[model samples]
Target chain A: MESNQNENKLYILFFLVLSVILLFLSSQMSWLRNYISYVYTNTSHDQVVNGRQVKNYFTLFSEIIEIKNENEKLRDENSTLKSQLDTISFLIEENTQLKKSERFLAKKSKYSEVNMFMGEGLEIGYIDLGSDNGVKKGGVVQYGQYYVGFIDSLDRSSGTVKLPYNRSSFIQVSVIKPTNIEGLNTDQLKRLVSEKTKSKAVAIGKGDWVSVENISTDKGVADGDFVITNDPKIGSYLVLGRIKDLDRDPASSSITSSIEISVNYYDLNRYIIEIQ
Target chain B: MSEVIITIFGIFLMPILSPFFYGFLGINVTALFSLLVLRYSHNLWVYITIFILSLLNDVTFHLLFGSTFISIYVSYIFDIIIKRVIPNETRTLDLIFTTISFFLFYVSLEIFMNLSSGSGFRAFENFQELASSLLYSFIMSSVLLLISMFRTYFSGGTGHKIIKL
Candidate 1:
């Protein structure tokens, strides 16, 4: 009984202290945390379960389960592909407008002249065109007319572009209300256009949401109005996202109310990084 | 050997089940882990294994480093205190201990995040989510523990009936 009196207390104290130190060090150096995550994921690729390797489970029942999961995955892929096809067709027209301008396209005749690089999210990407193909850092990456991202770092074979949804993305924006008004009076149309076009707002991306911190509370901005980038490089109006909702703080009679807009980054499959 | 098995089991199973409990508030597997550690393991390495399990969870969930481990450690300490205070094994005590353990873990995590990132409005929103998740976790953990007890009883262990408080 004396021998069995929990000697584990010493072990617990040691580990607890070690963990606290590691935590403090990791908080100061985020890269260390990232390195730990990288190591963990790589090491646990073939984890064991019930005395058997997880990857080695190839029984008939397991196969059926695998097939079911694969089916669901395929269904998701199908929907994503369908949406990409729709976006591609929409981009084709925009490409045509770009080609007409001698300055925008330069020597390139078609939009497809610039190679496409598909990215998983705002962070990592694989560009088909790299440094060898005139792809350089500090370049504008556009998906058709809309400036989606900019090339940050590049490799000899490929480049990485930071997309709009990333926290670092900042874009100057203006609102436009697109409608079917083929026969509206000139005076009414001009007045409507003037009212809709207000002071430019800076939109900062926060993951899936983009927030406009300064928009007039009384501005006749409504849901479904298209937000466009005010970048001068691309002379044409490019759509960013639609205004989703707005909230005002009642306590402070501030002139501007914060607006939250939704921008779906899912359907983007292709991008054109303008060489610096 | 059993310790190793439980460690592996916790590491693999917790991440899979976490998402089901995590929506409004993040319901982690740390509370369940501490409870299991208390029930089955006698070695000090068992706690270390649980801590490592939480670190693995942080990596898998893309959370800040040391967040899960710190929260789980706080919960583990809470478990130790409850165990020391009331060593009796009863359904009421188990439920109370589990509730307190989970609550402490969540509060510790919230404090860490708030202090680390100065997450002001986000912290308030997260607290609301935490409240909802706390109820979900308490019900789930208690029911699962009771089920395990019943299973043990049916398998021919010396069974104790639930007593009125």
Candidate 2:
């Protein structure tokens, strides 16, 4: 009985010590983990494993059915977390766009939403605004700050908006990769982008989209560069569209690029503005 | 030559084979290696060498650092307890203790691994698998232990020692 008691006491002490150490190690103590890793450089080849670049040989060789099932469960959980993260990122992006739209609205107080009657050839839009409503002949019809087209002709109560894709439309534009000149503000960047026509080209109508013409191959302009309106009559420094693709002609020493406008007409752009 | 082979197998091939055995046969060669090594060897360097081997095995197994190290510690501690508790050297007790030490080593290792993998107290959730693995480990270690004895007798070692009381 006395010997049995000693054995039980030893068992208790052993369990107590083991439990404490196990718990201590199990805790996510970064400092302790880092210390152990520093002492032992071969903590893991975790980069390759975690990056999913290589097969984790241990998992391949020794993972039992139960462990595989657990991994599947964790993968499902990871997918759910990834979707939740995407939702949050989308909300953040929408919030940023909303803020930018708000600033855009504040800057242009002379914006009016009008109905667009599509021309017979689907080339131009006849708007319900005219000179009587402060509508001018040369001002742009825009969606927020995105250049859609300009007022070609205006009468007592209506006007014609020449769409970017209209065959008769021709406008001078500048193209530049969006970059922040560290110390410059948006106004300063706007002045610089409006004045520097390094990517000077004419946007000509192509019935479906606008194509850049006469751009020199040495202009340093690439696809996806922002196309800004340089025609001061239509309002200077307004973003027209992004350069979709650039096709260079070696003989002519010129490049051709198509612009991908943000707004899709006849869908979400029924209501637009004549922003001066 | 045989001794060198067994050492190499236990130190090197056993780690790789252990995974194959565990995945299919459910035999724990790692536990078996610990039992045989501690049972036979007394050299400090031998223990240190096995400890290093255990470290390599942990990396190969992708287990948390020091998992196989703790398994070695389990065997060492059990050896101490048995030597201290038993008053006489009995082969039966030696076999029983070795098996028991293997059980403890696996238990500690599984618990540590499960905890590290975010399983928490659900370590033994696959109770049936764990039980069978322990059984296979016991059988393998016991068979190897008996084979080593037979080898000892054939080689004219201490296995054939006899005396009239």
Candidate 3:
């Protein structure tokens, strides 16, 4: 009975000792935590495997169904193509006539010998095709029929084209009125332009938007009047935004009108830089 | 001749295999296999093997340098802890310990890499990627343990005798 009691005590002591060691080892060895994470991950992976197999089976079945639908679509397309083949020669003749008319119209207009590679956005990197490619610094870059920006710096292979949307960029623009308005004098217009320059108009804050400031109500500058860059070297009148707001300057009694300029980056994305 | 060939193979193959397996299936099979191998042969040779295999893994995988170094070293620390603490050397206990060790190794590696790269604690931001990594580590370690058991059974030897705590 005494030996049995001693054995029981020894077993309890052994358990306590083992527990202490395990706790100490776990505290010191940081990898034990990682091992727990590993097990957890393994169990999760197994769960996912089971889940994904079911999902994949359904996805594959759906894909087969889609293929059948696509096959029917192709059959319809094939029959339509066959039907169109008879009219192909007649369409080709008409297409050639259209091409001739387009060419005639293109020949009559002035075409600039410039090519541009547009960037994805305002922050995109610029590459210059160089002066050898008729690209130079200070050259204007135009998107489909509107001025976007100009070349700021040039390299042998590429140039840095600065977008007009940059805050630092400033260009002189001409404010032209419709031919129907003849009563507005040039002095009145000059005063209007001067007042516009002085007023703190939000419209002219960035290159993306500009405002023509302080025109008199009598000068008759309508919403549709073209405001264009005054650079004769550019050789083309670019359409700036329509006048959105007309307001008189309260601080200046002489300032009577303001025209807000709109510049859209979307329209400017297609422009090629014209090398100066 | 065989020993020399195996040593060279381990040196060259571990790194290439680690990332390839990790990337393809999210498991570092080679690292786990190396750990199991090292379990039997706890000596200078084993440490050397671990170091070389880890170096190979680091170089071939384009992972940050010193990552494998730190991971294997930490794994060695865990091996010591397991040996010192677990008196019974039961397979279940070994598995549990190894899993925990593997997780800690991954966490340490991320911390070490972040410190070395100076990236601001961005590791946890990609929880899915981290989860996949942990899953791969567990799979690799489990397979390695199973293979070690199979190896012992087939050889009619207990493999490396577990050192008593």
Which numbered prediction scores highest in DockQ against the true structure? 1
Off by over 4 Å in 2: A1-102, A105-109, A120-122, A179-189, A192-198, A270-276, B1-165
Better of 1 and 3 by lDDT: 1
Cα lDDT of model 2 by residue, B1-165, tens digit: 244655676665654555555554456566666656655654444444465556555545545656776766776688678888994746676667766777777777777677667788444568785786468656765766675666566666864333212
Q: Score the docking of each candidate (DockQ).
A: 0.09, 0.04, 0.02
- How far out, in Å, is residue A44 in model 2? 86
Per-residue lDDT over A1-276 for candidate 2, one digit per residue giving the tens place of the 0 to 100 score: 787557645643564355456446635545544564554434233422342322344456556876889999999999999999987886676456434544454354566667677776547888888888888887677655567778888897998988888998888888877653334433655776856556788888989778998787887888778787777566545677878888876787788889887666664434446544
Could you give the candidate ranking by TM-score, starting with the highest? Answer: 1, 2, 3
Candidate 3 chain A minimal-lDDT segment of 10 residues: A196-205
How many clashing pairs in candidate 1? 0
User: lDDT of each prediction vs. the true structure?
Assistant: 0.59, 0.66, 0.53
| Interface RMSD per candidate | 8.7, 8.9, 14.6
- lDDT (Cα, tens digit) per residue for candidate 1, span B86-143: 8885877777677777777777666656655656423335557687657755874676
Model 1: docking quality category: incorrect
Give one digit per residue, the lDDT tens place, for model 1 in A1-276: 555454666666676776677667655666765776676654433332321332344365788998999999999999999999987886886465444432333343233345444565544445666777777676666654445666668888777766656677777767657553333332443445456675466677676556664555556666666566665443334456666665556564332323333323454445555554
The lDDT of model 2 is: 0.66
TM-score of 1: 0.40
